[model samples]
Target: MTLNDLSPILLDAAAPMINPRDVDKRLPDMIAGGLDAVLATAGAIEDFRTTMEDVAKWLEIERSGARKIKIARSVADIREAKASGKIAIVLHFQGSDAIEDELDFINVFHACGLRVMQLTYNARNRVGDGCFEITDGGLSKFGRKVIRRMEALSMAVDLAHAGPRTALEATEVASRPMIISHANARALMETPRNVSDDLIRAVAASGGVVGVCAAPFFLTKDGPATLDMLIDHAVYIADLVGPQHVGLGFDFAEENEEDYVYFGYDERYIPMPPWTFPSRIASHAEAGNLESSLRTRGFGEAEIRGVLGENFLRVFEEIWGC
Candidate 1:
């Protein structure tokens, strides 16, 4: 099977948890639902170690089946896994908080197969401020250094939750193409977390791909966003940035109500502020449109192939050179 023939690789650039035991139970259902892969955040190096062990166990189960789960550290790995009818689980970090104040840990993360790392989540960090901050401070001294280190390590720098100034600054400084892995177009949604048109164009100009998110708040305020609305957003981005520069990073967290409450109460885990909590859960129900959008939006095998994994794979190959 080719990437096009395989199921959709739902790349959630930010997920609260990566429990191997939980994923083991979830993967079978996800596979049955035509889910080929899931790219999620480990938060930091510590999280990566824990998540990696769990992923290894999950893949072990797949080893016994006709289908398998493979960790993709490069474009070749993703393609090869697709051809073999396997899911390519690409490890990503959603925020720099897990890294703490140290920048050297980036190298440690790269050594451990971390393919993507974002600068911030929804608040201020050592690297820079998030979109919610009142003052949009651009990349700090340390942030620039971090970008340089990420380029050297060949990790894809993400600006998903970064503020406008920081996102632009990083785009200008990073040697390799970066991604706003999970976000929407601000022009459409009018959310601070969404990227502006100029930033979208800049990312495209830099040969980077923008993964439009399915979060409710990112879509629109009128009502629950259906698959058509999601596709409409994708089409809008494609029109502005070109098709090759757009993809889906659903940002879907498959947690139940209990999980939702647990995360909402946990100050550290919940990236958004208190005001944003209601919208988070309200937005959850509309995420199913993600797959439907791909199928109904006139996105053929090639477009779906690129949106599902190839676009991200190409960028990874350029940065990681693996």
Candidate 2:
């Protein structure tokens, strides 16, 4: 890989989904790991009230001392955060359960700095069915209206945890491309959470990019995954579609905590859930080397740059605007 591939503007499409209180504690690792910007999930499987409260904490972080991170409402703010040596944080919601029945809150949250929202988490919701849902019903009528509003407001649509049928159907309705913020190729690992080749192709055809997941047990079936394996998934999507449609969306939740309140704690009962914490892959502290590892494997600088951060940056520039 050439030196340019290692450019310092590493944008993590999806950092670990953590609580608002953890923002102050997680900022240092993001910088240390070579990340200049990240789409940090504010909350999932929650209501608008809780999601707003989470955003409130992020706002507090921006106002706090040292000011290590900044809120990124646009592509310009994201670049500014990187140039200033701070991690640009764009708030995200993993599931639309937070939207509840308030359709107008989509606009309200956009005004509050919320940029990304998925229709569902891991089960059926008002928006649609998740990957883990028994039925594969796609977007509901309300879900369609939600997408329209999201487009009008310019929020990135995420379908990472969405069921195959649901994700594909959502793509059919999205005027702009919808992103699978973090997921692996189902062709590689036969898990519900991992997306199918058809879904990946459709999303890319719609001008959206797929952020290859970095969490372990999802990348490989034989053993715990390494960066090498993670790249394999990213490259698979690039080869299937194009490098422009692939990016890094490592949902690296390395054993921070587990809430079995929903998915339960047994892997045998639900193999798809991340009940197995501490992904064999690297954590946020070592995220800086994600690209370095790619270089060592002899990837071209252009491809490395695209996978490292530029691809998602391009998508963000298009959807969120410069």
Candidate 3:
């Protein structure tokens, strides 16, 4: 089955020393790892000018390597990319800070090929409160306007890092499908970054899909995590919302201790070095192990396909309308 990761960090966030715009650097590895398409994270908590530069850099990379990477603006683009044996790169954001208080910039970025966007990163923003906020303010007036505009413009609204009230409020306001693009079940892991059952039910009730994250810290707090732990989250969501609303969103990244330190994640939430993922699915190249694990856990073929990519594709079609 084809795979689509809703939130793959294509660039090594920890290593700016390397060429950040060399988007195709992991192309061969992803292909070997069984990924057909990815909603490549393009910007997060960046200001307007910086985010625009990031988008321009991504476009330049696609232009220079058209044969290997296609900038997907619609479901048709993804389909064509798959047919042509090219990897689809749907530009995505992990926060709406880049748009700031200016709503018109949403149209500007949409024109530039950004298909998915999250409302907040991990704290309060102009849009709303992120998961890390001590007091959840929910979606602000500006945030509601942003969601309406995004729906009208055919862009996917993501709630990955949104606080409980923020996520619930956004779902209440959203007429079309919304997504928690990359989060795990809080019931299992007990982390604020993970979604609560209330949030998951609300999202799925609104016809949205939830992508299970693959970070070891979010999967388990004990020793090294195994692929079974990752599948456990997928199984929980699938059982809660059915297979059609479950998908993968491996927020994979190359990192060092300093990266998380600089990002200000709580020490307990940060896994100690050496930062190794589940051995069977260590890197993007080993993602196929997730499928094997799912099968071993008794998920049938159609359900497996949905978890792999179809669920996200269906939401993309319903929201993007292409």
Candidate 4:
């Protein structure tokens, strides 16, 4: 099916969605609105895992509905979800810390349907530091080994939060084409976490895909980010690395305003950089314009299909060989 057909599915999956902060909120209405599937990040799962019973309860509700949510591991799974009108989920970990430096646990997480894993988050971990670090020491020996293990296991590696040196080094060392799951262009936003043009070209050349994040901070600095600017970043990256190599990783969450506190600064671990949070950073709802932008920019069913999920689906197929 095409994205036009898939749009309602995505919207349905996004309905009520999964709110990691509050379990009291009932998403049955949202599910009734039409949600096909959800691809939740590690942060979401970590925050909610504390309430295992709550998680089970929510999943049970979804399964009981016409909109069944299934974890996606391969292209076939994504296609099947489209055919069956179910929501396909691909569990992605934003950092390795969820596993807490234990390599053996990777397989355990994988067994639980954790398909995509990034090496680090915003700060340093046993694997390596993020782009925000003053001194990017590149990947640790253990980091390289971890990446190799991920490749061997067919887990898609993500460089979204890694430092420039770390991301480049990891890409060079990885035997497979991995993903920069969610990021913007440094050329556009100039954030440390944004991928550089060279890195973009390298990733595309290696047959990987880059998901342009819908976060305002990464898209522009002078003012609030809109869907137009978000598409501008996509167009820019497509110019540098071809349209097929780019996708949308809208990094949006369903949490309420109160839950934004969890993202507050503590500074206990690392110092915050000046541009850590860009000016005019709006609420997560600001991302709602994404679909409109994609459509307005003349992205038809095929490109929209890819950017929506097909691109990542293709990369997963390439690395997972499924």
19-67 per-residue lDDT for model 2 (tens digits)? 5667667767776677877888887887788778888887776777456
lDDT of 3 by residue, 1-322 (tens): 3434343212111112112355557766677786777887778788999989988888787777745778889877887777677777788988998998899999999999988999998879999998888899899999999999999899999999898999999999999999888888998998888999988999899898998887788888888888888889999998888877888887776767876665456665666455767768677788767676888998997788778877888888899998
* lDDT tens per residue, model 4, 125-224: 7778776677888898889888988887899888878888888888889888878878888887777868899889878877888887755567765665
Query: Against the true structure, what is every candidate's RMSD?
Result: 5.0, 3.2, 4.1, 5.4
Q: For residue 209, give model 2's deviation from the true position in Å.
A: 1.0
Question: lDDT tens digits, residues 130-246, model 1?
Answer: 777779988999999999988878888998888899999998997778887888888877778788998998888888998877665577666555556567777888889777888
Q: Candidate 2 local accuracy as lDDT?
A: 0.77
Model 4: ten consecutive residues of lowest lDDT: 8-17
> How do all models score by TM-score?
0.80, 0.90, 0.91, 0.77
Where's the lowest-lDDT run of ten residues in candidate 3?
Answer: 9-18
Total clashes in model 4, counting residue pairs 3 or more apart in sequence or in different chains? 6
State which candidate, 1 or 4, has the greater TM-score.
Answer: 1
List pairs with backbone clashes in candidate 3.
Answer: none
Q: Point out the higher-scoring one by TM-score: 2 or 4.
A: 2
By TM-score, the candidates rank as 3, 2, 1, 4
Off by over 4 Å in 3: 1-20, 271-274
Compared with the true structure, model 2 gives a TM-score of 0.90
lDDT of each: 0.68, 0.77, 0.80, 0.64
For model 4, the stretches where C-alpha displacement exceeds 4 angstroms are: 1-37, 43-67, 253-292, 298-301
